[model samples]
Target chain A: MTQQDRAHATREAILHAAAQEFDRLGYERTSLTAVLARAGLTKGAFYFHFPSKEAVADALVERQTELWAQVRESWRLRGVDPLSALHGMFAESADRMAADVVLRAGVRLNADREVGYPGVPSTHLMWEKLVATYVIEAAERGDLRPGVDPEAVARTLCSAALGSRLISSATTECADFPSRIREVLGHVLPCITAPAWELSGSQSASEPA
Target chain B: MTQQDRAHATREAILHAAAQEFDRLGYERTSLTAVLARAGLTKGAFYFHFPSKEAVADALVERQTELWAQVRESWRLRGVDPLSALHGMFAESADRMAADVVLRAGVRLNADREVGYPGVPSTHLMWEKLVATYVIEAAERGDLRPGVDPEAVARTLCSAALGSRLISSATTECADFPSRIREVLGHVLPCITAPAWELSGSQSASEPA
Candidate 1:
């Protein structure tokens, strides 16, 4: 293998190990030594890849943001309108959150302001802004009810989504995350759907599209 | 003063001081020494009032539970219907959360499961159950939209409320918590309120009744 290829592999190993530790112990409690031990790498090799644990956490948050962006683009590329894209985007998100260690670690780290990791922007804010853009687009397409403010609808949706994750995680080890989010959409979507769109709707947004 | 009164005052002082420390430092980072210092009490006095920090957290959670019960009873005594009682209960809750340090500390501690304070039940579950009961009552009174599940609306509302608090605190020091929750109710309430009640509704549930 090329030297560059080996370096990339080493870096990926360190990141994966660190994410596991963070996912298990949370940001403040996770230690650098434990990460190095998990990665089976020397201290020097670990330092060569990243400056500090906080930097590793920041990278994880960035990667999670990228995951959301990818989901958003994939749905948009399918030629679905903004309202329909939301169902696709969040379904992809719930699937990733349930299985990806990095995504879980990043979410847990970002939620913890106590860790003082200000190197990266708030992922929740980014997620909310993305949802807001969709809401605005849906409004322009006359999918939203008249007199509904796009920003308000977006904020409410984002809040409810996060709340669902918290409640589901607490109650059922997050086994019901998808259904919880679906229920949120089911109740809120009916209130916001335009009269024309409501009449045209064949199924609820919470259901498979 | 009687010995009983003096002992009660001492316990209250210790609890108040511990809450401030938890609010500032969170569950994992807060040290018992700091709480003692903040309360300006000797080690003997601290031990006399509480056995450990975990016990203190348990007490705080119990106290927060009591606060919710107070709000629920106040609304029930007013003879308001189930749907209307929710508005009053949540408004009072928001006011208490905004002004009470103990309530803030309790919420923070309860959210952190890492502390292992299983001595008390999950407060979120209790709150959700209370909401579910109200929703069921509303359904029985023909206040809810037909075919809507009372438990589902209750779950969504509770989740949205927590999400609003998380977002508001992260962005605006929680100054807009009331309005954020109001927006959630505004969007979701219309969907759940029966069409018959919809016509009778003069003002939005998001607004003061």
Candidate 2:
């Protein structure tokens, strides 16, 4: 590898170790020495890439943002219906949370205010904005019922997702996260979708007024 | 006052002080010495009632359960419709969380699993059970739409409330908790309530399917 490529690999290794340490012990209890040991790198090497623990956390948050943007772009390229695309994106994100320790750690750190990573967008707000964008498009296409406020439905969906994930993480350690997300969408979609466009049998299509 | 009454008062004072301390600094950072100073009690007096910090946290969770029960009973006595009663109870609870230090502290502690209070009922499960009871009654009375599942709706509502509260607490320090709750209920009620029994204009009543 070239000198620059080796530097990039070292930075990625440090981030991977930091994510595992943060996920296992939370931001408050995770130790720099332990992270360095887990990364199999000397303290000098660790500091060569990231100056501090908070800097690592900020980088993780930024990485999550980039990851989500890529997920959205991939879904957009598939050219699916807007609501279906929203559901697919959320389900895909939940699957990633179930499998990716780095994503889960980044989410946890972003939620923790004491971590002091200011200017990092909250996961909830980011999800809300994404959902709202899709809901607005769906509404323009008459997929949502009349008078359904896109912003309100989007906000509720985001909150339900957040709440379900939090409970699942606490109770089952997120082993059931994707199913919980399915349940949340199942409950919420019936309230917002137009009767003719209702997607799942779990929801009864609303009758005409 | 009798000696026993004075002792009870002192115990209450110590708990109140501890809740404030824990809320401000979280479970890991709170100092018992600061709690004693806030409560204006000697360390001997503080230890007389509660053996340790974990004991205080356990007591706080228990207290929150009792408080919620009383709120539910008071709403039941008022003889309102089940869905409206649930909304009232949640709104009242949010108001209390905004104005009451002990209740807010109890909620924060309950969410933090590292506090290690075994067998303590999670605030989410407790709310879900309470919401389910009301939803079941509403369904039996035909207030909910056909095919609506009380348990599922209740779980979603509870989760949404939790997510909204978490977001509110993080962004606005929960100063906007009640309104956020109002938004959650407004979005959720439309999906669950029967068309003929829809509650308010804030929610677009689901058209008959």
Candidate 3:
């Protein structure tokens, strides 16, 4: 590998190891030594990519945010309706949360306050904004019921989504996270959707992206 | 104070201090020494009431459960309808979360998995059952729309409530918790409740109980 490519590979490896540790041990208990051990990298290489454990965590949060943005952009490019796109986005994210250790760790780190991570609140606000933007589009496209406030609906759904994930993590290790989110959307969509518009299928979002 | 009354007060004091410390510092970081210092009791008095930090957390969880039960009973006694009673119960709990440090600490401790608290899962299950019971009663009384699954609806609402509280705690230290939960119910109730039974007022639940 070229020097640049090798450096890139090492950085990705460190991130992967950090995410796994955070997901498994949580942010407070996870140590740089443990992450180094998991990555099988020496201290010199580890410090070359990241300055501290918090820096690794911040990078993970940034990466998670980028992943979410990509999901939204992909759905938009596919000409999916705003409402369906929102559903699909959460479904896709939940899939990642279940299968991808880095994404799962990012989520856990964002939710944990004791870590003193600064990006957690902004991450939540970003999701809220993204959901609200879609809600507005859906409202304009005649997808939402009359008199539904896009911002309020967005906040409610955002809160519900947050709650479902936390509950799943606490109760079941999120084995059924996809279905749990589907259940939340099922209850919520009927209230927000225009009576005339039928949901193509409630299970569509849970399908692998 | 009599010996028994004085002992009871001391135990309560210790739990209160522990809750505050847990709420402020989270479960992993909160030290027993901090709790004792905050309670103004010596190590001897603290040990007299509790064996260890884990024991204090367990007692807090138990106390939180009792507080929830008390809210439900108070609403039931007042002849509130099941749907309204559920709203009132959550509202009252949120109020306590904002004003009562012990309850807030209990909630944070329960949510923190790194603490390795055993009662956490049971606490969530207990809430699910309580919500389901009320949802079943509401359905039986024709308050909820037909074909609503009590268990499913209960789970959804329970998850939503959990999410709202967590969000509020994280963002605003729960200053807006009452309104945040009210918003959750406002969106959810329309889906679950029969159209005939209007919520007396969305903000009514926020009123002092």
- The per-model lDDT (C-alpha) reads 0.75, 0.77, 0.77
DockQ per model, Cα:
0.42, 0.36, 0.40
- Which ten residues in a row are the worst by lDDT in model 2 chain B? B200-209
User: Model 1, range B1-209, lDDT digits (tens) per residue?
Assistant: 89999899888888889888776667777888998898889989888988888999899988987876776677778787787778666655665666667886787677666222323355567768889998999899999988999888888898888787666655654557767777787798899988766422222334433
Model 3 misplacement above 4 A: A1-14, A32-51, A113-122, A140-143, A197-206, B1-18, B32-55, B79-81, B113-122, B140-143, B196-203, B206-208
lDDT of 2 by residue, A1-209 (tens): 99999999999998899998887677889899999999999999988898999999999888887888898888788777788777777777777887777887787777665311223455667667878999999999999989888988888888888888777666655666777777677777877888888442111112100
TM-scores for chain A over all candidates: 0.79, 0.82, 0.85
Please give, as one word, the docking class of candidate 2.
acceptable
Two-chain DockQ for model 2: 0.36
Q: What's the CA RMSD for each of the models?
A: 4.6, 6.8, 3.9
Q: Name the regions of candidate 2 deviating beyond 4 angstroms.
A: A1-21, A32-56, A79-82, A114-146, A196-209, B1-17, B33-52, B76-85, B114-130, B133-146, B197-209
lDDT of 3 by residue, B80-124 (tens): 678887887777788778888788887777766522232354556
Q: Residue A186: error of model 1 in Å?
A: 1.2
A20-49: candidate 3 lDDT, tens digit per residue: 778767777899999999999999998898
Give the lowest summed-lDDT range of ten residues in model 1 chain A: A199-208
Cα lDDT tens digits, model 2, B1-209, are: 99999999999898899988876667888888999999999989988999998899889878887987898788778777889788777777777787777888787777775322324556667667878999999999999989888988887888888888777666656677777787778777877888877452112122100
Number of the top candidate by DockQ? 1
Give the native contact fraction of candidate 3: 0.37
Question: What is the TM-score of candidate 2?
Answer: 0.75
